[model samples]
Target: MRIVLDGISRQMVDRKVKAGQVLAVPGPSGRRIYPTFQFAADGSLLPGLPAVLAALPTRDPWAVLNFLVNPDARLGGRTAVDLLRDGRVDEVVRAARHLDDQGA
Candidate 1:
């Protein structure tokens, strides 16, 4: 499956996305194609990326940060997807934001 993200969602991705612009997927098998460069690629959508943050449990601006960086600190390729599926994304973001706010 493929998705196109835009608007505030686009900003969210831009803030945390890598140069490759890899969208967080459901599993490791989900291919991460660069939508900005290739519009019609297998496992990718058209125009732009999908609004993943919009689908989150809350509208916290920090959630996108947590999602993108959370996987950076983990070895498991599917860690980010797991966080989303389990509904712990918001909690993780909140905790991360709190830590950041406290300078910890």
Candidate 2:
């Protein structure tokens, strides 16, 4: 099944992602955006995100936020859009394995 993300959610996810950022499936739809931190893994906002997000203003809406979103970016990582377009678990898994091998 495909996951749906709103514009704000898309923006947040996009910001969290970098061209070479480490990627881990975490699980199906782990890319979700939660409205509150209570539902997050640590019951706190994703590190180093709110500051930037706050500056942008919360005009967009998103859901099912994952805890894995990284703040310290390492540009050039895979993204949900990339994976969704690929449509191959093996390729994704292999790419992830490679990233793991690279110490992602």
Candidate 3:
């Protein structure tokens, strides 16, 4: 992941995760594993990802991943990540904001 980030320091990555500016899921070995999907090919975060992350109902990384990958009715049966990849960030964020109301 560091290589993908172009050699960004661990501390910097940690800070980003802590700030809710990046997503890092826990691996089997208890290491935080950063998902590549959240980043563009150039290694920057997908646009508006930070806002979506912030709007998520849960801070749990696993829940966050599930929310992003699962199809949501609010998003017209598309996954949040899919909408994000398509640059429909406002729609994703809107869904995320209402996730808790739907008992997600």
Candidate 4:
């Protein structure tokens, strides 16, 4: 699931919070959609999520979003967000490094 800037905050979006990962991607008819996982229930970016985003192999929004949602063997078959929620930032960083090294 995704959300537009209006669904979150225009100011945060404009500031390119968390390396701009929280910003929405333009879609058909000029729609913008940000990955839902990038935001928490309190409407703040999840802690340490940007670190993984920073270490991503690609800066493309879709790719980075997919990486966050997909399961990783290094994460013990858990998604990046799951690890982050569990306070396993080290593992997430390692997973990001592995992806960077593998050119994924």
Candidate 5:
């Protein structure tokens, strides 16, 4: 992640994670591992990711990650991350708001 972020300080990365601007899942050794899919090629957070994160019903990192990557019928069978990548932020946010409505 440091390499991908162009060597930004670890503190900065941690701050981003703490601020809910980035996604970091737990690694096997209990270290935070940032998922590359959450970042654009330029190492910035994917557009509208922060808003989607805020809209998600849960704050658990694993559940949030699963919601982002897993297929959802609410999204017409497309993953939230894919829709976000395609600039369909509103649709994803709407789906997220109703994640539990249909037991997603």
Candidate 6:
């Protein structure tokens, strides 16, 4: 799921995106599409999410999104986002580094 930044608190979204704590992707129509995964049901950022984002292979939004949702062998066939929510930050970081090692 995705949300237009304006759908939420614009100021907070802008600040988070600027701080590299949130990912704002360019949508087909040239609007910013914020990934819904970045926010909890309560509209708060998931704990330790920014660190996971920082450890990702690339800053390209699509790449980041793919990484977050794709299942990984190292994660026992679970998506990185699942592991992150399960508090498996170190494992996620290692998996992310694996992507870098393969030059993804």
TM-score of each: 0.26, 0.23, 0.89, 0.76, 0.88, 0.80
Please say which candidate is ahead in TM-score: 2 or 3. 3
RMSD of 5: 1.8
Error of 3 at 48 (Å): 1.0
Top-scoring candidate (TM-score): 3
The regions of model 4 sitting more than 4 angstroms off are 1-9, 21-23
RMSD of candidates 1 onward, in order: 11.3, 15.0, 1.8, 3.5, 1.8, 3.2
- TM-score, cand. 5 vs. native: 0.88
Candidate 4 backbone overlaps, count: 0
lDDT of 5 by residue, 1-104 (tens): 25365457778888878888788999988888888888777777788998988888888999999999999888999999999999999999998887667565
Residue by residue across 1-104, what tens digits does model 6's lDDT show?
A: 54544356788788887777898888888888877876777677766778877777688888878888889777888988898888888888888767756533
Per-residue lDDT of candidate 3, residues 1-104 (tens digit): 35365457779888999999899998887988998888877777888889999998799998899889899989988899999989899999999888889454
lDDT of each residue in 1-104, candidate 4, tens digit only = 43454465666675675455563566789766666777777667777876777776677777777778899777888999899988888889778867855534
* Candidate-wise lDDT, in order: 0.40, 0.32, 0.87, 0.72, 0.85, 0.77
Which candidate's lDDT is highest?
3
What TM-score does prediction 6 earn? 0.80
Give candidate 1 misplaced runs (Cα > 4 Å): 1-3, 6-67, 71-81
1 against 3, candidate with superior TM-score: 3
lDDT of 4: 0.72
Cα lDDT of candidate 2 equals 0.32
The local distance difference test score of model 1 is 0.40
